[model samples]
Target chain A: MPPFKDLFKGKQKYVTVKPTSIQTEQPDGLWTKCTQCGQLTYTRELAHNLLVCHKCGFHFKLSAAQRLAITLDEGSFVEFDSNLVSADPIEFPGYAAKLEKTRQATGLEEAVVTGQGTIGGYPVMIGVMDFSFIGASMGSVVGEKVARLFERATRQHVPVVMFCASGGARMQEGVLSLMQMAKTSAACARLSEAGVLYVSVLTNPTTAGVLASFASLGDIIIAEPGALVGFTGQRVIEETIRQKLPPGFQSAEFVLEHGMIDMIVERRDMKKTLASLLALHERRHEAG
Target chain B: MINLTLDFEKPLVELEKRIEELRNFSREKEIDLSEEIATLEKKAEMLRREIFDNLTPWQRVQIARHPRRPTTLDYIGLIFDDFIELHGDRVFRDDGAIVGGIASLGGRPVTVVGTQKGRDTKENLARNFGMPHPEGYRKALRLMKQAEKFHRPVVSFVDVVGAYPGVEAEERGQGQIIARNIEQISRLATCIVVVITGEGGSGGALAIGVGDRLLMLENAYFSVISPEGCAAILWKDGSRAQEAADVLKLTAPDMKRLGIVDEVLPEPLGAAHKDREGMARIIKDALIRSIDELSGIPPRRLVERRYVRLRRIGEFMIREAAQEGFAEAASAGGDVLRATGPAGPKGEAKR
Candidate 1:
């Protein structure tokens, strides 16, 4: 078994922590309740469905490696900047220790894993963010990796696909974390100028700084079914506006309805969907 | 009286109130409390120093967001003369959260931009609590572009919690505008100076915050997220914001040490709220110094320097070993010399 699956074995931190509420905690073990539709799901069966509950089509968070496995062709991922670790720029208290704990738990040096991979024989650059790693916050290393991924993809004359699953910008890194939003967005702008097809796949809980920048700058934005995507939390907005938000206000369906995202693809069809996008782009390239 | 004193400043507030009461009593009763008042005044001054000097990161945050703290318009009014306020983004309705205009600073024509917040609840709603929408950023960028075109320096005041997260703001692409500002501002072919007069939260602060010389007031804060947000996300408890602030290192001194800020402009004795004009004068001097130093450089050189300054932000590996004197001194010294050595002017001379 892959380390990612093993990481989930006998422990399920992902299921317990929902983005919307701190009070909501799922019961431990094989049985889990979906926060969205409140469906009782068998954990094993849910994993087989790419962590999506079959009853409600709510996507569960996946580790970066798990995402790469499902999206890329077999044995195609060649990870870049794997050893680029984070530094305590401000020597932020307990940050290094917290980072070490997360590294041990997730087997990721940073929140994001950037690599070159093939999807249905189409070569591309890919980055997958693991929400398990410190809520997949974009710090300096994540920014550097994502920026490098785009630069490499543009240079290689191939498409780019990124799986975004973040809580927000990493607060521990202070201003450095916020700078990533600009850095990644600027990198995306360069990629756009190069005329490369960039597909951003928003997973469960893409919010704040990541959602406000490159995640929203994709040539084609695709969100997993029921993925939460927004610049800020519902609670924060509600506090500001002093009104109750609509149900699923920042959900994938809501974003699609609001014309922010291009489409919502299920886990079962994501690989095929990406392959078709690559093929279409190739045909367009030829025609042009 | 309705006092909005911070937790740490409560003792000082009490001292001041006692002093006030004693003064009134002395005036009304014709009693001599001069000796008592002198003693209390000295104690109050010392207490103020102690409290401010040893302020925790969270305390600094409170001061930065103080209700009486001078806002962008206050700074503009005090620093620049003959200001002509500009409006509208042209692409969308003018976002009042951010206000900018052409202004004169020490006889030099420059463009000034800043995030505007309100003093009270009604005005806060009108300005979106100083949180700008996409149009706000676009308007600032438009003004900045105009500054670049006219060969005028751009000065911006950064004081925001974050970009507005309203449904309308998101629908209009808030992310794109902030992102574009950072990108364009980095390559803008003119001198740029940014002053953080208050809260500098996340990309909202960063949108108009990047410049050749980023100056932050003594009590100002610039962070990726509000301490409350950080606390809520990290500890699952927003009440632990004080603890989060300590860990965030968002204070101006912390930012200066990290090279995120070029300089830390001194605020008044109590805070910026105590003396607005004094704080503004310090900011004006810093801006003038930055502009004068940068104005002589060619546009291309200015842009390159700004790019290098931004690119050099944040810390990474190899500091520990170097600090331990693991590397040879000769090589390290040579590397620093090479890195800081001037290349542009000498190359031109050679050509």
Candidate 2:
């Protein structure tokens, strides 16, 4: 619940001159004001409750694992491409070492974790993007892993549900990372063409090249209660065009009301809804 | 009663608080609150149904655009197998809007393409609200070509609002890209099937709109321009978009009647959002049959049929127009020319 003032300033953890890993050890007491109620809360408590604030009912940043555990059936997830990693295809200065450090710290090979699991007893494929990993950027490896998951699901003829949490395309991969968006989307398209049900779940803070590509092509789109959903951040968009956002702009529920998604699923109901849809799709196999 | 509590211990506490408050109030022996609670519950259910059933076109637009509405990623999990995502337009930058790759469609090898929108804020910033830039169109054209080359049928799920209109998109030649997609897809030597799965507005929709058989979901609307854009131009106001939508005949029934769409797939009683599986099956059937029909067509016939379809599109319009006023113009012109002894000025004849 840090004030968006710092985010507005774009104070990122970029070390342009140093190629070493920025292990930002806690510089201050790991607690701050709630984004909703301005109540001071401990960071670890929020982390334990899946980034959801206890007092003000505010949701904070969620790790990919936290998202998967919340979404999948109890102990049913099996991760795919856990070893697949991202390379600095763009050669952005200091990006590769930064990626390595983030990789080690997050214990995730790539930004996305493709999991095969049951949500409400229905067999489905789920991919959760971890923003902790390079802003949960979409890269070639992420795309490939996603595409492979799609292929697997298509072969299995089951439904796919992706939880997208990204900062758009990974700049470190340069055009290669950008290509991941199209590639991943193409894989989703194949799933759709094959008559397999594919639904995209947009999570908190999805943006950039990833949104432009495949994040929106869902059979039944779902978003977390208060996730930010838009093409650009408010500040950057304002700076670029010097225009103010309409009231309630870019929130998940607002986007839903605006006709962008199907439902604003609570953190709890996502799995059950997914399972019911999958089971129904299985019974109603009308494809040639 | 079955426990409605699934997760979030806090909500349970809040509900319990309300329940205790109600019990205490009712236990006073003077007032019976159970009836009020039941009435309120009934009212809530009725309101939910009314809201779900009576969604306006604008509200439907919102539903079609709900941020949480599942995206292509969700579908891949529900469907598809071993999807090897291909990259690059083979000529320029890869466009994120047009997603294309190889995968099995109901156990058959097929090339797939879809326009993707983002779910959260950062991804939407990246995906550009599911609008394909020129590069996105080019990428689709390449995928269609690959499908044709391999004799694999192509299935495209189109849901873009339109091509990106940014300076970057213009600089990348948006018009040329759209024109080229029209040209290539019209003559692409593969059985192409397109589904207007969602918005399907403008060229972003048409980039994938060309196909041997075009299908649209009941709740899905496809049009030459968005209703708002259409209204703004036709009525000089954007608010009349709903009327424009009704008259423009941009719905599935309208498009089907106009022969612009091959089939109007039915959703559930409410909408596809209510019955995602039902809608998926409708699409799957349309895709499978269209692919079956287009797959066995000879390469020459495949391209020829498409060309013929395009060439034949305006036959009714041309014929109808000819009958309505062209005949009178021809007759009048003949008389005028004869009266002038066939030596009239060329510019005067045009008038």
Candidate 3:
């Protein structure tokens, strides 16, 4: 009764039921897929590893709070400029709404969180950038906060450590964003003049205005492994040169090869590495 | 003799052409048409004023990018004397994109550094289309530091599309070099003046842009990113650059209003490209005035004032509840954070 094709189709429908285990959903926030190696990892394990992929060593971006938590001594952080927020300086379209939504979603007043904390028992002033909040762009508020951090550090004669992770100047703030480059750089100049040890740590994706300002002015510039650190973005460079970029272009390894950074440190070793550097530059007061 | 004509400048060009035609016609025919010629000349003058006086931000951007626009070299030749060309960053080969040396302004020795643009195709290639590399910025920093050492006022002229965005530029540490320049120049221990002569594009322009006084030419623009770059990033269309320029607030008046630039020097009737020498003379005068004004302050105070000027540049807000506590703490810290006060006199930041 069946033609050759119809006979095969009827036979294939005999076992259509699927297994229930594959269809059941796992609890949310329990697992994270590796962006580099495509490996499913327990979120708790990932956090314990400081958000670095255990399988492929991909250093995931960290929020300001998360960065502060892992880098500082337990319960030693005191935040500054927590009430500062951005204003629509240029009145760029949708900027206010974007800032509002980002503030709510990230629960942050600005992209960079300035504070005081001890690293490996060495007291230091610190500023950590949260890339999730608008690429940690250096808008007016970000600039003011960074400048204040350096100023405070300079006055207190404390070593300053900064975790720079930005996509450059915020476009919505217009030229005000551009001036932040000068503003922050001026502060770095003051810090250097005061002989304060400024350690700038470049995390994943530090480029453009931020890179060309305080991020690059560090006394010892250290970058995390596999971080994209450069003045220009890859897409912009590709378009300008009209060619595909080689793999690892603008990565921390590439930058180290080019002699831009002092060293490349892994996420887990960052705290110990920074503590030693701060200890080496620790100020000693003469006994009266 | 401008080789490039922009869309907005077309009407003024047409009016001037009509006036020229009338003059030629009268001379050729040996007719008494002086009155008609005079009338056309008056109309052309008014049209020129009308076009230049009320230029839109996008129009100013066009003028800034005009190929015939006067270059830094041209201004140096016209305004300064005894200009000895300097070269090389010592670590790298001399970059043609930036030109710098010691020169005399009105018999006062000053160090001059400027981003150079070429006049023609071959020159543009050599100049890398006015885009500096790491070496160029390094050379600039070297020259500026020398100026500081010699107690010479550093006068820098800026006109660049951006820092070069090529693979080689990236590999050579363009970002670090620029960062070094900005930091070193900020507390340079000498009076410094910066003039934005044309398109000041992003961090590239800012590599040599910080100073005690920032002066912008009438049609020149200074932006964090180029309008085309912003448009492509935000609108996903590079052609929407005109719209982006409007929103960037990059015009000279915008800079003045924002308290970023100290002064906006007026240009010739048809912009700098139309009257290069006149524009140079105006810039020369402004440079003299700025340098004189800045030279009066001692070096330490100059650096401190420079710090304060830069410190007060940004705009931000404080929540109403946090304002009082912030004000008291910031006042104790000093005037650096006084700009953070809510409803301050600058009125830059609002609740």
Candidate 4:
């Protein structure tokens, strides 16, 4: 979730009902390449499969909205802070409006969405990020909200599940944003040590500042299919080393294989998987 | 002429084909096609599940890194109660790599330490990809010590490739910070349990690695060096990483057998990414067991046992082939060595 040159990321509303086979005497479907597997995958096919390469099993790019769909129960999700906004405390050129545009474009208040919901009939705390929202940056509000969420979850005695998608600290918010990582992580740490079930789902593009803080502090980590789950992208590493990346570098599978992730799952199974997992957490708690 | 781009319109593909055929049969301008569009909408329901049935590891990584994947802040929304975030490594500049605070874990006071990676370009630069600097490690040490002071056990989730290696990080004494953690964590009296919830790499991992019990997620990895780095070192080419991984024996199954780790928390077949709840439950159970085990022992014993266990890493391993000759000779009636000689047990040697 860096300055990903994407404009209409999450809020790219479709004029058509859904992105089905829509051809109007013109070809609007774009040609995309799967960087990991190095195969020619149609944008539509990759999109249909939730950014996973059917042939090579490489995970494609994703945003927060996509994650909510994959993890939450169908029709059970209620987005929070659709209107919360970020001000240009740094006054970086065009940053304020940029935040506005990003908010509108991603359909999110800031970068994160904290809510109360159920994955499989198990009421739990939920936090999802939208990388498109200024690269899913963490700022004061983001941190504050996270801290509040943890406190709330502990109060409810419900397990908390967080999907981590961050570029790290929010630079635009300056030091204030950076502080949020500590604050939020601290909140998570308390919940975890107390023996409350804290499940963290590491998602695509988790890196940098975020990786150093709460994102890395999950009790249980789960990943989605074919995500780029590293703090440093292959591009940066390649540039640093002045060499080409190896096959499957930085992909979720590579991370999983490297022991960076707990599990790799398809989007369809995320809900049921979470439910069963939550059930087990309760059992463990009882036994404990 | 299949449109791979048309995943949402499988029925449309057929309808469009029929429309084409009809047009071929009668080229009059009196056909309306809007009616057929409505009929093709039903299959979209099933397609949702159809596309996400089975995901691959690479795909799962993507999900794990999805910009939309939840963040720590989001978790705050869903987990924990009465959470308060404390600041400053209580040192120079506050390190962002490690986050710790006071919060209730199952309504009990506990301290937590975890790595944080950023989601975007600028943030990534700032956080250094969850790679802690000396201060981050120090801050974690500070918080953990505080927990120990309160007689509260510490919980840590490890996820990082290593400590930051930037020039600034080096100047800040990253090594010193991590070394201090090793010293402090080893002697701390309170129970300590660590979970390799994600990537556990390098000394950055070791900074929080000194604990009473270590649990790793099923697919999570713990290694001295990343496979890619190892490949680069051995083959002078990072591309041979897969071959290195095949030989590294760094996976949970291998590590568990090696006794380097205590337990491998089982993830759903594909991974914990699919089953967050299941993963959470496993961690909770593991945490309880780990705490119970650690708490059972006296504090002094806890410290000594952990130290001895770490020191005894290679105790279980021996060069069988190299020693086989000497062992066999002794077994075959060669003079037995010191303590237990050939007259005692077979293969007993003084050398």
Q: Which candidate comes out best when scored by DockQ?
A: 3
Q: What is the docking quality class of candidate 3?
A: acceptable
Off by over 4 Å in 2: A1-32, A42-49, A284-288, B1-351
Candidate 1 lDDT, B1-351, residue by residue in tens = 335788888899999999999999999999999999999999999999998888888889999888888889988999999999999999878888999999999999999999999988888879888989988999999999999999999999999988887778766666556766777777788999999989998888888988888899989999887888767656667799999898888899988887788899887788889998888889989899999998999998987677566545555553232121111211232232222211110000000
Candidate 4 lDDT, tens digit per residue, B1-351?
322322333554565566566655454666665455345434433443443443332232233333433334333323445767666686676877677777766666777777766656677677776778778888888889899889888887787767765534534544335534665676678888887766766456767876778887766666544556545544557676555454445566656776667898776533554566666767777777777767778887886676555533421112123211221222221121211211100000000
Rank the candidate models, highest TM-score first: 3, 1, 2, 4
Q: In model 4, how large is the Cα lDDT of residue B255?
A: 64
TM-score of chain B of 3: 0.90
Candidate 1 local lDDT, A1-288, one digit each (tens): 011122122222333323333224533334556645667665545666666767777666666656776677766777777666799886777788988887666455678888787889999888888776877878888888888898898788789999987767777788888877767776776688789999999987677778877787788999998777777666666677788877667778888887778999988899999999999898353554
Off by over 4 Å in 3: A1-29, A286-288, B1-3, B322-351
Give model 2's docking category.
Answer: incorrect
| Tens-digit lDDT string for candidate 3 (B311-331) | 998888887654233222322
What TM-score would candidate 1 get against the native?
0.81
Candidate 4's displacement at residue B162, Å, is 12
Pairs of colliding residues, candidate 1 = none
User: What TM-score does the first chain of candidate 4 have?
Assistant: 0.78
Q: Model 3 scores what on Cα lDDT?
A: 0.83
Instruction: Give DockQ for candidates 1 onward, in order.
Output: 0.12, 0.01, 0.24, 0.01
Point out the worst 10-residue segment of candidate 4 chain A by lDDT.
A7-16
Candidate 2 TM-score, C-alpha based: 0.45
lDDT of 2 by residue, B69-138 (tens): 5565445444567787887787778766667799988899988888888867677777777888777888
